[model samples]
Target: MALIGIISRELGNLTFLVSLDLGSNKFHGNLPQEMANLHRLKVLDLSFNSFSGEVPSWFGFLHQLQALNLGNNSFTGSIPSSFYNMPKLETLNLKFNSIEGQIPKVIGSLINLRVLNLIGNKLVGFIPTSLSNASRLETLEISYN
Candidate 1:
C-alpha cells in the first residue's frame, strides 16, 4: 500500500490548466471536487492510481475537456450523466474499476468521441444501441466482467 494523502484542493487555483496528468501514482481517495474549476482543461488523466469513491458529476463543468482517463482505479458507481454535456470529449476511459450499471444512452451525444473503454468492471446491462449515434467513434472496448 504505497498510497499517499488525498488529492489537494490547491489544484483549483490553476485556472488556465489545459493538460493535467497524474496517472500511475500512489494517490488515494476521491478526487477533490475543486477539480471542476478547471474550465480550460483539455486533457485530464488520473489513471492507474488508487483513487476510490464514485466518479464525480461536476466533471460536466469542464466543457473544453477533450480527453479524460480515470482507468484502473477503485472507483465505484455508474458513469455520470453530466458527461453527456461535454460535446468536445473525444476519449473517455474508465476501464478496470468497480463501476456497475448501464451505460447511459446519452453517451451517443458525444459525437466527437473516438475511443470509449469500459473494460473489466462489474457493469451489467445492454450495450446502448444509441452508441450508433456516435459517428466519430472508432474504438469501443467493453469486456471482462
Candidate 2:
C-alpha cells in the first residue's frame, strides 16, 4: 500500500540529497513548501500520488533539479512561471493532472530539457513555438488534452 499523509519539512534539512523518489504513494495535501530547501536535489519523482493544490512556485528554488515527475496526481492550476528558474532541468512530466492554462513560453528557456510530457490535462491554447528553443528536446508529448 502507498504511504499516506502530508510530507514533513524535516526532509528539507537533508541538504545533501541528490534524488528523491516518492512516487506511487498515497501522500496527499499540498506539497511541503520547505521542499525548496533541498538545494542539491537533482531528480525528484512524486508521480502517481494524491497530492493536490497548485504546484508550489518555491519549487524554483531547487536550481540543481534535473528531472521532475509530478504526473498522475490531483494537482490543479497552471504551471508556475518560476519553473524556468531551474536552468538545469532536463525531464519534466506533469501529465495526467487537472492543471489548465497555456503552456508557458518560458519553457523554451529550459534549454537542457530532454523530455517534456503534459498529456491528459485540460490545457488549451496553441503550443508555444518557442519550444523550438529547447535544442536538446528528444521527446515532446502533449496528447490527450
- Find the candidate with the highest lDDT and give its number: 2
Candidate 1 regions with alpha-carbon error over 4 angstroms: 1-3
Instruction: Report the number of the highest-TM-score candidate.
Output: 2
Model 1: how far residue 85 lies from native, Å: 1.2
33-128, model 1: which lDDT tens digit per residue? 899999999999999998999999999999999999999999999999999989999999999999989899989999999999999998898989
Q: Write the per-residue lDDT of candidate 2 for residues 1-145, one digit (tens) a residue.
A: 5798988978888889999999999998998887899999999999999999997899899999999999999999999999999999999999999999999999999999999999999899998998999999999999988
Residue pairs whose backbone atoms clash in candidate 2: none
* Deviation from native of the Cα of residue 127 in model 2, angstroms: 1.0
Candidate 2 wrong stretches, greater than 4 Å: none
Model 1 / residue 38 / CA error / Å: 0.1
Steric overlap count per candidate = 0, 0
* Least accurate 10 contiguous residues by lDDT in model 2: 1-10
